[model samples]
Target: MTKIGKLYGVGVGPGDPELLTMKAMRILREAHRVVAPVSSDSAEGRAESIVRRAIPDVTIERVLISMSPQPVQGRDSAPTGGTSADQGGGTDGYHSKDSGYERAARAITTWLEAGEDVAFVTLGDPHIYSTFTSIAAAVIRMLPVVEIETVEGIMAFQSLAARTSTTVCDAEESLTLVTAIRDTSALERHLTDGTTAIVVYKGGSRLPEIASLLRDTGRSKGAVAGELIGLAGERVTSLDNDEELPSSYLSTVLIPSRSMTKTVEAGEGPA
Candidate 1:
């Protein structure tokens, strides 16, 4: 009965390999096991993608917790094709009624119970809109004895700003990042509120709605689209008009909090 080393939930950042911090790389390369989340049993895993891009040759064991088709299809299965097979080979989809967080906790507890250290990698900073928080919460309640550590990484919003030469905020300003779907109804409130900047975390399908909202509120000039920032397919499209955003999930829109005021103060053209 050996005591297991701690579990490290490492943030791999948006999608760029260079964004990986040295400490995160060091922990990932040395971890005994790595866990990632998957949307479907058939979809590619984001955490694993980060690991492969950072340290392709590491030979640690891999675990995956599928996020959809609730009632977690497989909890005990062997890793196959760089992924895990379901309880019945591949027929049953891997998901859980308890959501991805619970399934991940079960997997991690199994490793911890066996005296094994594990690392769960996530995209972007764990504290910043990452799913690692849900997994962390579950682990704390169910496997209280297991030690947990977190390693932060560059945030997607920061990376996106860097790639586009857009200033997220100055020392005199502040910012708020929210998921697209979660904050739709607050559109009017946020516009009137003094939150320096609003970073719509996922603006794919919401792109049109967002564009419409901005136009209707007369804030279209402050809106811009950033997709796959820091990755190979990165695209930064500025929308001075409301009809040009391409459909994309990795997309985000930035609306300066006092866009009109800023324009007036600087005597600059709108957006």
Candidate 2:
């Protein structure tokens, strides 16, 4: 019997190639071939871009996974006009026979069955709002005995916090991470919940609305927004100055908790 190769889902961190972890780099170097998801055959995806910068000589296999969610009959589909990162993770609770995940999984399975370890690279943490989750799940369903592992990577919120010199949260303060691709009702609720710091992702298009909600809830005092952090066109600005916020698909907004806001106001810095 031939030995099946292990599958590794690696996170390449946010845009910066230098942010790639040592373990992730080692796995990419040792893997039979790295698989990177792309919106189309010709387009280079963000994850692949980071990998190429870090390991220029590594072999990469491109997988076409549409950035937009496909409409499923008789089921409520995600709202349109958001990037793949904005679409959230997983198969959205359902999978189709001819779905992108199915095709990607089949292609990967062939390599795994051939005794070749494959590394599927993703941006940020593979478990956090990453397409790798969907692809890995599909592969597991097909090959039940295959070993799957994940490598952690720095999240955008963490990078944005460092760029803006703002502390994400302190002791006893809850942090809520959410995507603003849909409505603002959930975001509004988080704003009003005392001691909760909210990090909103894919909120570039809804900056104005988010700003208004922050103000209405008094969470806009130290709010900050970052776009393309650690990469080209990087911009980090105060949400108080909405005009300065970059309206890009890679935008991330961090609204500090009331306690942290008080700490900054008092010039004590983060505790």
Candidate 3:
């Protein structure tokens, strides 16, 4: 049997093809197989989107992991449009990432068993709210001999802060990073504890609710919204309360770590 290949989890950054790290680029260039994640909501894969542009000349076998928030409607049938890999065809009754942990693990295992290096591409950094970590854990159990490597990429919060020219922290200031949700209880908790700067990632669709949540806390005026970070059609909207909030899952909200101290420091203001 051929030696098992290594599995690498690479953070491709947030939508910016240029933001892909040198290490990630090198691995993608040299890897024998690559698995790009495609969300259940859309056929388009942001990780694959960046990969296609960044390494136009590279060639490798690739797989698509469709992670759906809910059970996929079609578990037995192949998808209408996409390669076999895109279809995620499996003998087992697994369809979406939610139920396809074993399938994904087996898929990566197949490549590794062939002595092929595999790179699992993810958006932004893998450590912060990424699916790669979860999938990797399952894959490891399936293939105990497989080696796993993790590469860091620029995070959405860091990119958002840079694009808006806002300072995330100023020496000794603590920052809260969490997912944006409709419920304001979490936001209320942070504010109650005197937290100032918060980076809400992956909740672009909840902008209005987020805006309202901030308004309830009287922190709506200084909030900043970043969408599509380094990619085209990027928008950075600054709110001052009472303004309409647009929706985009690619969106990120930046709130000053505190009241009366956080103002726009500088960078590209509003798209």
Candidate 4:
């Protein structure tokens, strides 16, 4: 019997090519085939861009997948329009089958069945709100015995924290991570839930509302927003200045806990 090739889900980190982990680079270079998702045939996905930067001469296979939020009516069918990779940053919401996971899975399966090791490169960590999860699930359903492995990559929030000189959380504190894509209710709740810190993702569209909520909840202090981290047009600024917030889908907002902010202000720094 012919050996079935394994599938590796590789996280390419945020936008910086230098951030790609050594293990992920090795897997991508060694894989029999490398698959990168794209919003359209002409547009290069963020993950693909990072991979190309790190491995200048490497060839990659591009798969078209919708990254836009799916409509309620056609949740199961493929969505029509351009797709975006996870790192491309956009409004966040519940994903649907229309995102084209099944199609991508089928294409990947063909290569695996041919005994070709396949690496699916994604932006950020594969386990964190990544499209890789959907495609991997579909592939598993089709090929039950297929071998799979995941490689961890640095997330945007971590990069944002580093850039802004803010600590995500300290000892005995809780951290809440959410998306501000479709609604701001959850984001509001987390702000007031006694959580030590809150990281809002895909919040570029609702920056104003989020800012208001932060003020109303008295969590506005030390709030920072970052866009296009490690990429062109990158901006990191205080959320206190509404005019400075970049209204791009790739924005990330970090609301540090009041206690931590206070400590930093007093020159005590994070414990």
The candidate that achieves the highest TM-score relative to the unseen native structure: 2
Alpha-carbon runs more than 4 Å astray in model 4: 73-83, 86-98, 267-271
| List of clashing residue pairs for candidate 4 | 39-83
Residue-wise C-alpha lDDT for candidate 3, range 181-264, written one tens digit per residue: 334456567764445578776566677777777767677655788877777778888865555565666678888755323343
lDDT preference between candidates 1 and 4, better one: 4
Worst 10 residues of 2 by lDDT: 85-94
Q: List runs of model 2 lying over 4 Å from the truth.
A: 73-80, 85-97
The CA-based lDDT of model 4 is what?
0.80
Tens digit of lDDT per residue, candidate 4, span 126-229? 98878788788899999999999999989888899888788778777889888766668778777766556999986787787888888888787778888888
Name the best candidate (by lDDT): 2
Sort every candidate by TM-score, greatest first: 2, 4, 3, 1
Q: Which RMSD does model 3 reach against the true structure?
A: 6.5
Model 2 per-residue lDDT tens digits across residues 1-271: 7899999999898888999999999999999979998877887778888899999999899988654555567767664335653223343433344657788899999999999999999888999878888888889999999999999989889998887778877788899988776667778777778688999986788887888888777788788898888777888888775465577878889999998888878988766
Determine which window of 10 residues in candidate 4 has minimal summed lDDT. 74-83
Q: Which residue pairs show backbone clashes in model 2?
A: none
How badly does each model clash, as a count of residue pairs? 5, 0, 6, 1
| Alpha-carbon local distance difference test for all models | 0.64, 0.81, 0.67, 0.80
Locate the minimum summed-lDDT window of 10 residues in model 3: 80-89
What is every candidate's alpha-carbon RMSD to the true fold? 7.4, 2.3, 6.5, 3.2
Better of 1 and 2 by TM-score: 2
Task: Put down candidate 1 lDDT per residue, 141-167, tens digits, no spaces.
Answer: 887877889999777677766665565
